[model samples]
Target: MIKILKEVFQLYIDRSDFFLEILLQHMAICGIAIVIASIIGILLGIIISEFKKTTSPVLSLVNFIYTIPSIALLGFFIPISGIGDKTAIIALAIYALLPMVRSTYTGIETIDPAVIESAKGMGSTDYQILYKIKLPLATTVILSGLRNMVVMTIALGGIASFIGAGGLGVAIYRGITTNNAALTVAGSLLIAVLALVVDLIIGTIEKFIKRKWKLN
Candidate 1:
């Protein structure tokens, strides 16, 4: 086991460039997808919040998309987008929309009704109430949703490698196909470490926001 571990470490050191490239590609896919999803999610959340009756149905539809298998979804889009980063981004974006949309909607909706009424009573327009009261109050929840979306995007980006999206997943898939257990272990470890680092950063941000906003 020690010898195998040493070999894996050595392989990582020697192929660090390849690993970095994979990491960059993964980040690109995840970052872009999350950004797009967040915009759409927040907008939909805002719109749905305007109509209390439609919030549940709209969120339910988004949640349903989350249940579809990533691979199957990718396959469904392959013909339209072809196999590459585009399809990967689209799939991950769709998957990410659920948490963000739900969190945003729930966060806004769950705000104190009294507070909203107070804002209105103070001569605040509908736009002012939304921007100043509802959104500010919901900031923590929105951030939490973004955090979840980031984590999910990273995980799914890995699977996107199977379809030629090129990332840590490529390293992993190649390792498996070539029967290089060392490579597979190394690649998987790289992905795990990357995800851990990202989550840690996001967690720190979430904590800061929660405290700053006194959400706790």
Candidate 2:
């Protein structure tokens, strides 16, 4: 184990460029997926929150998709989208919907009814209420969801290399096949570190937002 650790450390230092290339690939894949999930998830969340009637069915569908195994979902998309980052992004985005939508809904729903009524009394337009009141107020919770989605997406991005998406997973899968423990361990560590770094950044943002809100 010590020998393997030494080898992995040397590879990280000596071949930083090689790892950096794949790291960018991983970020691009996961970043696109996160954006897609946030847009559609937030939209669905808003819609369900407003309509209330649609909440059960919309959430139920998202929940169902979220429950599908990531690999199986990727396989299902392969025939239509074929093998590439697109398919991986789609799969990751789908998996991400539950957290984003749930948080958005919960954040909006939990806001005191009186606050909204006060906004209405102040002659706030629907758009103004949503833009200024609901979203701004719900941002902390939404950001919390964003953090989870990002971390989860990055971890899942590793599997994307399996479908030719090209990410840290390449190192991991290739290492597994070729029995290169250092490569495999290095890839796993990079993915984990990426997740941790991203989570911490978002957590910091959440803290800042919370503090600002409290001050107000």
Candidate 3:
């Protein structure tokens, strides 16, 4: 194991450029997917929060998509996306929806009804209340969901290599196929570090937002 560790460290030193390129690819795919998922999830969340009757159906739909196996989801998209990062991005975005939507809904619904009533008594319009009050309070919850999605996307980005989406998973998959423990370890470690870094960044932002908005 020590020898394999040394070999992996050497691989990182020798192929730092290629490793960086793969890391960029991973970040790009995950970034795009998470952003798109945030928009869709938050929009649906807001709409469902307003129309309480629709919440169950909408949540159920996202939940169904989330429950699909990653490979199967990617496979289903293969025909249209034709085996590439596009398919991977779509799959990851779909997978990200459930957490975001659920968190947004929970956050909005959990707000004290009396607070909303007080705003209404002050002649606050629905739009004004949403923007000024509800959304501000819900920001932390939404951010929490985003954080989870980002971490999940980073992990899933590795699976995208199976569809030729070209991330660190490529190295790991190749290593597995060729019994190259060093390469596999190198790829896995890079991914772990990347996930940790992203989580920290998002967590920091979450804390800042909560403090600023007094959402705690």
Candidate-wise lDDT, in order:
0.86, 0.93, 0.91
Lowest lDDT 10-residue stretch of candidate 2: 158-167
Arrange candidates, best TM-score first. Answer: 2, 3, 1
Task: Give lDDT: candidate 2, residue 64.
Answer: 94
Ranking by lDDT: 2, 3, 1
Candidate 2 per-residue C-alpha lDDT over 16-106 given as tens digits, one digit per residue, 9 for 90 to 100: 9989999999999999999999999999989999998999999999999988989889889999999988999989999999999999999
lDDT of 3 at 16: 96
User: What ranges in model 3 sit over 4 Å off?
Assistant: 214-216
Q: What 10-residue stretch in candidate 3 is worst by lDDT? A: 207-216
lDDT of 1 by residue, 13-35 (tens): 89889888898988888889989
All candidates' TM-scores? Answer: 0.94, 0.97, 0.96
Q: What is the lDDT of residue 128 in candidate 3?
A: 97
**After best superposition, candidate 3 residue 154: deviation in angstroms?**
0.5
Off by over 4 Å in 2: none
Clashing pairs in 2: none
Candidate 1 or 3, higher TM-score?
3
Q: How many backbone clashes does candidate 3 have?
A: 0
